[model samples]
Target: MSLIASSLTFMKTPLTAKLNTQLKLFKIKVKQNTMHTLNSILRMRRDIMKLLIIHPHLSIIGGSERLTQILVYELEKKRKNIEILVLTGSRNKELFPETSKIKFKLFKEAPVKAKNLRIKKLINAFLTLSEVMDDFCPDAVLTMIQEPIYLVLSKIVKPSIGTAI
Candidate 1:
């Protein structure tokens, strides 16, 4: 199990302490259960398990993007039945030449005025992602960032996973 730490403002409040404790406990639980989870997956009768990894952008080389790419490579190397599909909004495909081992889908670009409309662009991104999620029907969805699409995913029947980093 991998843990990504984010800077949290330290405080004396009980909420802060509780949050820290909960994180520690969650980490321990994951460490203990990881082996069992992998064994369960190995025993599953299904021929293939589709994993959709959502990374909003891949135009730049960032830590999260690198991590996602490494994860896809490692998972595919371990399990032949696991299919990794990287869903991104990045138009610059040349930057991710290392991801030839995994499948990728460039989501439809959301049309908006070429003016300063950040909110509208975000909304379009959410809609495009929603459509992709529906079409893919993946067994699991890993969202790298918390976007409005995450909220929409929570209401769907499929399982969605999110990370703090």
Candidate 2:
């Protein structure tokens, strides 16, 4: 018989009653330790809030771009402890002086004259966003515009990430 089976047999004897009680206590201690470790992990996750902002394109100065810039500025001002990262398909930071300090991960711009430009842009955005999500592991994602790709990617890559449009 296996050591565990032999131990079970031995534990059944009246003489080993104290050993069986100790084993039960030991199991309880292991369970408590496991619970404590899991709680610590959850508390650590709560301590650091990471926010990822997805903007497909920031090359031009537009209403949506301005709103994103303003949102980043306000978030930085108010949430000092929260980490923020902006993921964009293309960016011309010079166009927005207000967002000069914002952290941005810019994806390679698709060739203007290339065929299937829209498809290429979409693919690039999806891949880059996936990489960013893996590396940063943001707690939440915010998008200035209604982009289904962002929502879909967040669900695929990290379902735990809360997405806000």
The positional error of residue 18 in candidate 1, measured at the CA in angstroms, is 80
Q: So what's the TM-score on candidate 1?
A: 0.53
User: How far out, in Å, is residue 92 in model 1?
Assistant: 5.3
Highest lDDT among the candidates is held by which one?
2
Model 1, CA-based lDDT: 0.66
Report the C-alpha displacement of residue 65, candidate 2, in angstroms. Answer: 0.9
TM-score of each: 0.53, 0.61
Error of model 2, residue 130, in angstroms = 1.7
Q: List, residue by residue over 37-135, the lDDT tens digit for candidate 1.
A: 887877763667777777878877778777876787788789877767777778346645534346787756577655667666566656665776677
Per-residue lDDT tens digits for candidate 2, residues 56-150, read 78998799999988888787778656677888767876864434335788875534454786777766666777788889888888988887777
- The segments of candidate 2 whose C-alpha lies over 4 angstroms from its true place after superposition are 1-46, 95-101, 108-115
Candidate 1: where is the Cα deviation over 4 Å? 1-46, 91-95, 98-101, 112-116, 146-165
Query: What overall lDDT goes with each candidate model?
Result: 0.66, 0.77
RMSD of 2: 7.3
